[model samples]
Target: MELIVDATPTATVIRVMATRIDAPTALQFKEDMRAITAGFDGRIILDLANVEFIDSSGLGAVVASMKQLRPDQSLELAALQPIVEKVFRLTRMDTIFAIHASADHACAAGNT
Candidate 1:
């Protein structure tokens, strides 16, 4: 799980650089997210534009990432591919997150 971290005034964007987030990479993803987000004080926009697929374990990792955040911090999702979006929707996880069309959009929305 390769993720590019881009910090802006409004939010920290973590762009996932892989096509798939499945069983094999789920643990690494969680660990990386923990390291990247530790002590972060603002919103985190997870850019999923490059992720074409995701499995249940991958989804669990994402949720776990959010759970590990500090009380003042947040985790949001953006630029989800169709398949990945479907997975979130089918699982109703979409209701648990603030989903954006893109990272830019998420940043533009600010704290909303």
Candidate 2:
């Protein structure tokens, strides 16, 4: 997983440029997030622009990261490909994680 971090006024944006987010690399992705935002407070906006696929384990890892964020921190997802959006909607996870049209939109929504 190749993740690039950007600071937004409302959240930390992470653009993931990976073909697939399956079992093999989910853990590393999660660990990378943990390491990158160690002392930060606010929200996480996962920009999934380049991710074409995600399995159950990948979804689980995302949820786990949200859980790790703590009592007040927020985790949101953005720019999901149609296939990935379907996965979240099919699993009823769309209602759980806030979805946005873009990373900037995600950060803006989280700010409010």
Best by lDDT: 1
- Model 2 sits at a Cα RMSD from the real structure of 1.4
Residue 102 of model 2: what lDDT? 91
On the 0 to 100 scale, the lDDT of residue 19 in model 2 is: 74
- Give all candidate RMSDs, comma-separated: 1.1, 1.4
lDDT of 2 by residue, 1-112 (tens): 6889898778888888887888999999889877776656778888998989999988987888788886667888999999999999999999999999999787777657
Per-residue alpha-carbon lDDT of model 1 for 26-101, expressed as tens digits? 9999999999999477899999999999999999999999999999899999999999999999999999999999
- lDDT values for all models: 0.96, 0.86
- CA displacement after TM-score superposition, residue 46 of candidate 1 (Å): 0.3
Error of 2 at 60 (Å): 0.9
| Alpha-carbon lDDT of model 1 | 0.96
User: Ten-residue segment with the worst summed lDDT in candidate 2?
Assistant: 33-42
